[model samples]
Target: MKLGEGVEAAIHCAATLASVAGNSTMPGAALAESFGLSPSYLLKHLNQLTAARILESVPGPAGGYRLARAAERITLLDIVLAIEGREPAFRCGEIRRNGPVKLDASAYIKPCGVNAAMLWAESAYRAVLAETRLSDIVAEYAAEGDPRAFAASCAFVERHQRPQKSNPTKQTPARS
Candidate 1:
C-alpha cells in the first residue's frame, strides 16, 4: 500500500526540527522553501503533525513550530498513525459470501485467510516502524555527515528559524 500524502515530508520536517537548537522554532514558509515544496502543501502536513502532538506551534512574529518532545521518544509508527490514522489499511468485505460459489454460512464464521494474512503483515510493518524513532534517523545522519558541514547546516536552519520567546514584562494578569 502507498503511504499517505505528507508522510515523508512530516518525517523530514521532524528530523530538521530535532537537529536545531532547543526551544527554537521554524516558520512553515522557511521549512517549505528548504524542502522545495509548496508552502500550503507542507503546511497541511505540519498541521497534521501538530494535531498529533509531534510538533508544538508557537504564535507571534518570531513564533513557529518545534517538537513537543524528544525525537527519540517519537516513533515512525506514531507519525504514520498521526497521518494515516489507526484504521486498518486493508478491509475485507467478506466477498466470498457473495460469489457464485455459495458456501455454507457456517464457513463465514471463521476469519478469512486472506484477511488474516493482510492483518498479520500490517502488524509486522507496524512493529518495524514502532522500533524506528526520529532520533535514530538523526543519529544516522550525524554518522554520515561531515562535522563542519552538518554544523553549518544546522546553524543555517537556526539562523533562519524564528525562536518563540515570551516577554517577561508582557505577562497577562491572572483572572480570578
Candidate 2:
C-alpha cells in the first residue's frame, strides 16, 4: 500500500526536530524551506501532528514547533497515525458477496479472506513502524545520510528556532 506524502514529511520533520539541540523548536515556514515544501501543504500535516498530540505548536515570536515527548518515545507509527490517521489503508467493499456470480447472503457468512489479508498487511506495516523511533533514525543518519545535507538541515533549524520557555503552563502548549 502507498503511504501519503504527509506521512513522509512528518517523519522527516520529526527526525530533523530530534537532531536539534535540546530537542528544540522550528517554525512551519523554516521546516518547509528546509525540505523544499510548500508552506500551506506542510502546515496541513503539522496541524494534524499537533491535533494528534505528536507535536506541540507555539504561537507568536519565539514560536515554532516541538515534539510533545522524547524522540525515543516517539515512533514512526506515531507520526504516521498523526498524519495519515488510524484508519486501515485498505478499504474492502465486500465484493466477495456481490457480483454477476453472486453468492447467497447466508453462504457468505464466513469473513472475507481478502479483507482479512489486507488488514493483516496494514497491521504488519504499523507494527514495523511502531518499533522504529526517531532516535533510532538519528543513529542511522551518520551512516545512511549525506553528512553535508544532514548537518545543514540541523543547523538551519537551530539558527531559526527559538526554544520555548519551560513554564508548566507553556509546557503543555495549546494547538495553534
Candidate 3:
C-alpha cells in the first residue's frame, strides 16, 4: 500500500505550478534543483503529469512548463494517478482459494465478511481522495500564510529560473 515518491513530487510540482502567474512557466529542472533532485528523475514525474493533462510543456529557448488547467479543477488524486498510476492499491489475491481445504462454492459465496469489509474499506479510501482537491489543500496552506503572497513567491521562482540545458547523458537515479 506504499505509494512512490513521484506521487508526492507530482502533487507538489503541480500545486506550485498552479500558484505561478498565468504568463510564466517553471521548468522541470528548476523544480528539481529547488529540492536537490536529479533532473532526469524529475522529468519522469513531469511527463506523467503531462500525460494526465495536468501540465503542458513548452519547448525550445525560453520554454518551460505550466498547468493546463486552473488549480481549482485539479485534485490530489489526479496527481497521484498521474505519477503512481490509477491501479488499485489493494489487489485482492483471493488467497482464500489457495488453502489445502478449499471450500465449496456454496460455502465460499457472498456471506464471506472479509470480501465485503475489504470492498467497504477500499470505497471509503477512494471517496476521501476524490473529495480532496489540490485547491482545498492550497486553501488550507494559504490560510496559514496568504494565498496571494504564496502565489507571488511561486511567481518569483518562475521569473528567476534560467533555461535548462539539454543533457543527453543524464539518467534517472535509481530508487534506494
Candidate 4:
C-alpha cells in the first residue's frame, strides 16, 4: 500500500528533530527549507504532530519546536498517525458479494481465505511499524554520516524566522 506524502514527511521531520543539536531547536520553517517545502504547509503537518503530543510547539521569541518525549518512546506508527490520521492502509470493500461468482449460501459459515490473509498481513505490518521507533531511524541517520545538515537546518530557521511574540505583553529573549 502506498503511504501519503504527509506520512513520509512526518517520518523525515521526526528524524530531523531527533538529530537536532542539544542546544538547538528545530522550528517549522527550518524543516520546510530542509525539504524545500512551504512553511505554512510544514506548520500544518507540525500542528498534527503537536495535537498528537509527538512534538511540542513553543510560542515566544526564543521558542520553536521540541520532541515531547524521547525518540525511543516515539514510533514510526506515531508519526504515521500524527500526519496521516490513524486509519488502516487497506480498506477492503467486501467484494465477495459483488462478482458473478457471488458467495454461496454458506459464505457466512466462515471468513474467505483472502480476507484472513489480508488481515494477517495487515497485522504483521502494524507490528513491524510499532517495533520501529524514531530512535531507530535516528541511529540509521547517524550511520549515514553528516548530521551537521540538521544543525544547519536549525540555523536556517533561526536566520529566516521572525520572532513570534505570542503574549505581546510579555517579552522573551530572542533566540541566538
Candidate 5:
C-alpha cells in the first residue's frame, strides 16, 4: 500500500514536537524548513493533524503547533488517518460480476478472496501502526538513531521553539 508523502511529513513533525519543552511550539514554516519540504505543502498536512486533534495550533506571534495530548497517546495510526483519511488502501470493484463469464449474483455468495486477503493485510498494517505511539518513535530515534543527526535536530528545536509567556498576575497571589 502506497501512503502519501504527507504521512511522512506529519509523523516527522509530530516526533519533532515531542522535543519541545513545556508549552513551547514550533512554527509550521520551521517544521517545513527542518525537513526541506514546501511550507504550503506541509501546512496542509499540519492543518489536517490539527483538525484531527492530533496536534494543536496556537495562534499569534509566539504561536505555532504542539501535540494536543501526550506523545504516548498519539499513535502512528492517528497520524496516518489524519493525513490519509480512513479509506482502505485497496478498493474492491467486484470485477468478477463484470466479466463475460456471466456468473449470477447468487453464484457469488462468498466474498471475493482477493478482497478478503487484501482487507486482512490492511487490517494487520493498521494494527501495527496503532500499536506504535509517537513517543515510541521519538524514544527509538533518540536511543538508536545517528548521534550527529539527533544533536542537530535538538539544536534546531531549541532555536525555533516558542515558549509561551507566563502571566505574572496568575502566578502571584493577590494581597488584600
Candidate 6:
C-alpha cells in the first residue's frame, strides 16, 4: 500500500497549521519552505485538502491556509483520503478470469481471496489513521520530538503566520 508523497506533505502542513495562533494563517509558500518542498507541488495537495474541507484557504495578503475545524476534529484519514482519493490501494483486476484455465463466471461466485485479504488489511490501516487526530500528532511531537527541531518550527511559524485583523474597520493611531 504505497501512498503518494503528497500525503506526507499534506499531513505535515496540517500539523503545522495546528500550531498557529488563533485566526492566524500560514501561507502555502511558507509551508512549502518549511518542508523544503516546491510550492507548486504542495499547492495541489493543499487545494485538495481545501476541497475536502480539511483545511480552509483565505484569500489576499492577510490570507493563507488554516484548519477548517479544530485539529481535534481532523483525522489522518481525512488528509489521506483528500490527497490519495477514496480508491482502495489494491485494485483487483480478476486475473483469475484471464488465465487459460478460464472458469465460468459462476465458478467465481465467491470474492477473490487475495482481494478480500487486501481489503481487510486496508480496513485495519484506515482504522488506525481514522483514530489519529491532527491534535494527537501535534501533541505527541510537542511532548517527545527533538527540542531544537520543535523550537525551530515554532520560530518559523511565529515569523510567518499572519493573524487576521480583529476589526478590519478599526485603526490604531500611528506613532512616531
lDDT (tens digit, per residue) of candidate 6 on 26-80 = 9999999999999999999999999999888989988999888888888999999
lDDT per prediction?
0.83, 0.80, 0.73, 0.72, 0.91, 0.90
Tell me how far candidate 3 lies from the true structure as C-alpha RMSD in angstroms.
8.3
Compared with the true structure, what per-residue lDDT tens digits does model 5 show for residues 68-171? 78888889999999999999999999998896688779999999999999999999999999999999999999999999999999999999999978655633
Candidate closer to the true structure by TM-score (higher is better), 4 or 6: 6
Query: Candidate 4 regions off by >4 Å?
Result: 21-24, 100-106, 146-176
TM-scores of all predicted structures: 0.86, 0.89, 0.78, 0.75, 0.93, 0.93
Tens digits of per-residue lDDT for model 2, 1-176: 88899888999887776655553578889889888999999999999988988787878887888877777888899998888878898998987777788767898788889999989988998899999988888778856889997777667866877776677554442211
Ten contiguous residues minimizing lDDT sum, candidate 3: 167-176
Off by over 4 Å in 1: 145-152, 166-176
Residue 77, candidate 1: how far off, in angstroms? 0.7
Candidate 2's error at 59, in angstroms?
1.0
The 10 consecutive residues of candidate 1 with the worst lDDT sum are 167-176
Model 3, 1-176: lDDT tens digits are 57898887787777677665544568888888766788999998998899899887878777777777777777777787787777766666777777799877776666547767877886787688778887777677767877787777556675654444544584312110
